[model samples]
Target: MATSTGRVTGTARDRAAGADGARGRGRPKKAGPVRRSMSQHWYAWAMVAPVVVVTAALIGWPLVRGVYLSLTDATEATMGRTIGVNVIPSTYGFTGLDNYVDILTSGLFWDKLIWTVVWTVACVGLHYGLGLGLALLLNRKMRLRSVYRLMLILPWAIPSFVAAFIWRYLYNSDYGVINAMLKAAGLGAVGWLDDPTTAKLAVIAVNVWVGVPFMMVAMLGGLQSIPGELYEAAEVDGATPWQRFRHITVPGLRIVSSTVVLLGTIWTFNMFPLIFLITGGGPGSSTEILVTYAYREAFTGIRNYSGSAAWGVIILLLLVVMALVYRRALRKQGEVW
Candidate 1:
């Protein structure tokens, strides 16, 4: 009996040891943090690699090349030779800030800069006013609301170049619809695109028309998002329409307004086609903005590629400053919220 009990006890101990040994062998080894992290994110990195490569090849390379070109004295005659593989006749050397200096010394730069600012502000302001007003009207219960919305959005749907062409015809001095209307009204004919002040105003008016529809749509969406209870409560408290708009509507639409205004400002600042197609920066460069001037410098006679690149850099710097300010303002608003 004692011998049998010893054998059973020894068998049980052997089984337990074997089980533990199996478990020890089955367990996985722990990896180092860096290797583990790379293993986890390898798929994501692979997915994004193509985009990164394309961006570097396209935008990054062009920007670097443009800066290099700006530092050199590259004109129409020398541009191909400077960048070409084969030897050429003319020699070009690095100007090293000369292009920027020339631009700063010219009075034309300041004038165009000032006009660009004015143009952007005027267009964005008018867009907000007209858009908000129309949004308010549309937000109310009214007849044919869908039809009105569709009609209002038509201007924005049209291509900017087409709209500019249409406006150019409208602003023509002779045989234009605007002049004909003035003649019928017994008022003197006005040179809409001929006079410098009027030309600036004309472009602004056209831009406002093209931009208002987008603002109206954005504001309308924002207005719809506001709870009806807030307005009802305000009215119950004897708040006037203007008071409600000022207090409730404006505050509710603040975020949307800021976003649209920033986008509008950028778009307006870069608006080249409308100004180029309509006035061609004419009337003695009266309506010329920085973008138009840069385009003219790059493409017109002499083709001052380096000068145009310098202008582009200045524009880029200005945009960067604006973006920084906008981001700071957004952070402040977020904190308030």
Candidate 2:
């Protein structure tokens, strides 16, 4: 009985080996390419998975929820019901494009939009000019250059809210140092925050002061990266300073300037702290930008959260359009290369 069992086991093993050899010789075993690829990249995917999950949880979910809320009639009264809290026992319903229509039809929205544009353009333009000018001046060999750069950078190093608070006092109507200085100069006290035009200008000036250091630092780095030989060659050719600057300096800094301007525009567009802290979007919303308007809608009286979310979507669309235009401009300039 034992001998018969051993023979049967040996025969089965030999048959299995013969079948495996036949399969290997027939057409070559197929490689599972997709499985192989996944195996190769499993480690990379593992490393990236956490970041992807976190971003989805933090940014993606909120964005999706905001869009949903915008489509619904989700005011302060209905928000609790929508969230399952049922604090006020209200019901919310889909409103489709009503929020957007209302915003578009409102004169206040147009006014804020115009001011937002003016604020962004003016602040970014001044920041670039002041920063580039300072960068060029500092790039020249000068005494106490390090000290001067440090002093210029101090404004950027300070917290923006703190800077806003300090500026608020300076712009005070009565005994503010700025008014005192004007009085000393035989000029009347200017209503910095009180008047509409002056309030807008005052906030812009404060933003410019806070933002210039960043631009200056960026421009300085770009200036340093420029090859000295180019300047030397221009000098040897008897090129005037203005000619050299127009031809060489501006062209050399094109990429840097574009990047700085793009970032500065976005920052200035979304700037909330300075205006909120100093002006409170007050004196009848004179200095209110889109961001401030959205905040007021979401958090202040009435709490029109869905309306605010709609505004946020509009802001996002505007930013997307700006980014696309910038990218197209860069491509046209061959800067992307």
Candidate 3:
């Protein structure tokens, strides 16, 4: 029996070898290792190199040059050695802190800085209040709701320069929509842009109109994110509508609100188009914000390169401070949801 089993195993092995031999030496062997794509091997770098170089040329080079130029007395007419090129210390003299000192000492500079701060705060405040209010109203059930929202958001969706021009005409003392309405109500035409105070208010008003829709949409999204169960619970606890919003709605919107404040502050502080298009920082410079003033100083005024650089540094520092403040506030608020 053992001999028989051994013979059977040998026979099975021979049959398997015969089957393998019958397959005609198996299929032809596959080729060598797979080749990498051209992009995967080298072309990717070639493609991205241009973008990197362009970014460096546009952003990095200018930034570095500006900082370096800030340290020198290079002027519009003296930049390319038009005023005697030299490598000596006396030739390319360093200003050290004099430029900064001069800018800080100027009363107009401080006033412009203050105006920028006040304008940012006021516009941001009104934007927050009005936007939240409108968002809540629009979020409610109503007839023609979409139409109302569209009409309300039209001012913001329009290009700011275009809106500025439209408002400019609307604020005209003779035939402006505002003056016409006022006259219909027996009030005389108010010189919106001709008077200094009114001109500044007009700028703020236009900014508010242009900014509120974005703020409203942001808040509306936040508002809609609140679960209805919270409102149901508030109702069970006998909470009024105001109380429900105060606790539930406001707390739920902390993050979006913070973002709005941060963005609004930056945008308002840096706002230039409306002021430029509408007032041109006029009514005797009563509406000149820091950015416009910087533009004027750099391109219009005595073409002071160092002064403009100093102002740029100051504006950057102020923005940094504002950012830090926002971050600290965010930390204090923590995550609300």
Per-model C-alpha lDDT, please? 0.91, 0.92, 0.86
Candidate 1 overall lDDT versus native: 0.91
* Candidate 1: stretches off by over 4 Å: 1-49, 81-90, 335-337
Instruction: Give the clashing residue pairs of candidate 2, or none.
Output: none
In Å, residue 199's CA in model 1 sits off its true spot by 1.2
TM-score to native of every candidate shown: 0.84, 0.86, 0.79
Error at 73, model 1, angstroms: 0.8
Q: Pick the candidate with the highest TM-score.
A: 2
Ranking by TM-score: 2, 1, 3
Mind sharing the TM-score for model 1?
Answer: 0.84
Query: lDDT of candidate 2 vs native?
Result: 0.92
Q: Answer with 2 or 3, whichever has the higher lDDT.
A: 2
Select the stronger candidate by TM-score from 1 and 3: 1
Candidate 2's displacement at residue 47, Å, is 4.0
Superposition TM-score, candidate 3 onto the true structure: 0.79
Ranked candidates (lDDT, high to low): 2, 1, 3
Candidate 3, residues 1-337: lDDT per residue as tens digits? 9999999999999999999887857757554443345435567767888999999999899877777767777666555443366533334457787777888898988899888988999999999999999999998999999999999889887998999899999999988999999999998999999998999899999999999999999998999999989999999999999999999999988889988888889889999899999999988899999988878877984677767777777887899998987798678767432
